[model samples]
Target: MPYLVPPHIPSGRIADGAQPALTADGGLCLRPWEYTDAPAVLAAFSDPVIQRWHLRRADSEDEALDWIEQWQEAWLAETGIHWAVVRPKGGTSDGAEQLLGRVSLRSLMLGTGQAECAYWTLPAARGQGVAPRSVTAVARWAFDEIGFERLELAHSVMNAASCRVAAKSGFSLEGTRRRGHLHADGWHDMHIHARVRDDEASCVPVEGAGPGAP
Candidate 1:
């Protein structure tokens, strides 16, 4: 007999060899980040727009490499899964294939089978549906491939573009966290959005800890 208790999901760490290579329209490919991707990582974080919302910045080549290392460590520790959003056949940069953006399943709260979704896009990749497409793909993988029960997304309320992405990516607005984010300017309110295993047009706000991840 199935009791009305929290679902039990198998606990496992994210391994690059086991990670699925997800493809989408417009020739987009989501793959595990590579050591060679350091340059693109540096270039992406240097963008003021990306740095604005994504407080974590890789100031130099070494820092960029360190950033990637943390992701790998997170995977081994079962804390996060990150994918380098790439446009294999569509984008170009100085005769190289540049990263379109990055999507991550961060803040892996395994006990509750929940994780947070975060992303940052290349300046050239914005305004073209890259973020939303990548987000949707990662969300689907989180739910279907990895058996994650809940995924959350939060953005500074001032970021209208992020708000739109969250909505289009199937994350319904859960609620707001007052004075949740601290930007270069000041503390800003945050909008929390979430998608669950059987979510529909609407979703209830996550209780307790507000959805604010960095």
Candidate 2:
């Protein structure tokens, strides 16, 4: 049996090249994770909020390193990619970057031109619009550069903060899935949000949160 349409993204289109660093609103940078970031990853997973929403914890630095390695490998595999959301330590371009959050295109389905965007901001970065900024940047890249037709974002209905981030990032609320996902506490209703490539509004950054803003 033959399909009527071609794959939205051709194979090797992403796996053939190196991942590029992305700049987002509010002086944020999204880059590939490095081994040196293991400590920060450990710290993030250690946070109670992250552990709850993410449903996993890094028990040690070595485990965190493994996770970083997997993120790098995922990019090469072209199944998905993850970025470390960072803020430069000083007011200069040469300054070191501090990790504030993470954004990823997970469960990538290139043939169908779809993927799920997931993110979590550090405790200190919460309420600072880090998640939405990173998400918007990634979505633009996915749509404009990679030719993906749609991106989805889903969160537990109980996660009000995540729901707000989805809206701010231009992912429209599609609907709710009853007990769609199981968290550590058990089942929870999930809100599904999405942004399509043709939606010009999806490319616009939220007010007061555009790139390079203070």
Candidate 3:
């Protein structure tokens, strides 16, 4: 079955003010992934931090292209939203559209208005509020325009930065699941956080407010 945007969602373009080229703090833009980005994606995934957090494997150029192509198809099919975090020209110290990271919402239940959120950022993008900003933008869109009732964010207990992002995005910590994933370190606990439509008032405005203020 084709994925459908919920009927209750107000009709409007999906990437309105949120265009792929749309600029956010630190000259970063959340753009749709493309096959041409395969090399950069692979390089970004090669980062030890990214691999550790996301459990990504080293991939050949062809494999990387295939992965991006699949994400493109999924986006067109409305099955989910996946975006590459790019560094805008003249913004970063290096004038390059480096792949700082990626963010996505999947396992969507439109009828029930719920989905799962996930993201990871390159080390260069860390400590700059990139993850929180990206997550906030997507979550607001999901709730206000996509008509989702709730969005869930889960992370390994050791991932303090991700936990901070969830909290900064107004997600209340729900609970922890014991032994969620078997990692090389050990069976890790998973921390779950959630944001509901009723808590829309908690969404921090995109333009104003300092870190963790919204």
Q: Write the per-residue lDDT of candidate 2 for residues 111-202, one digit (tens) a residue.
A: 99999999888877776678888999999999999999999998888888787788788899999999999998899999999999987544
Instruction: For model 2, give the 10-residue run with minimal summed lDDT.
Output: 205-214
Off by over 4 Å in 2: 92-95, 202-214
In model 1, the runs with Cα more than 4 Å from the true position are 1-7, 13-17, 89-96, 200-214
Against the reference, the lDDT scores of all candidates come to 0.76, 0.85, 0.71
List model 1 lDDT by residue over 88-201, tens digit each: 743664555667788899888876789999987776676677777777778777777777889999999988878877877779898999999899989999999999988652
**Candidate 3 wrong stretches, greater than 4 Å:** 1-26, 93-95, 200-214
Please identify which of the two predictions, 1 or 3, would achieve the higher TM-score against the true structure: 1
Instruction: Predict model 2's lDDT versus the native.
Output: 0.85
In model 2, the Cα lDDT at residue 80 comes to: 83
**Which of the two, 1 or 3, has more lDDT?**
1
Q: By lDDT, is 2 or 3 better?
A: 2
Top lDDT hit? 2
Candidate 3 per-residue lDDT, tens place, 1-214, comes to 7766555433233433343434455556888888888887788778777777677755788888988887776655556778887777776667765777788887766566678888877666677777777777777777776678889988888877677778777788999999987766678898989999878535542432212210
lDDT of 1: 0.76
lDDT of 1 at 41: 94
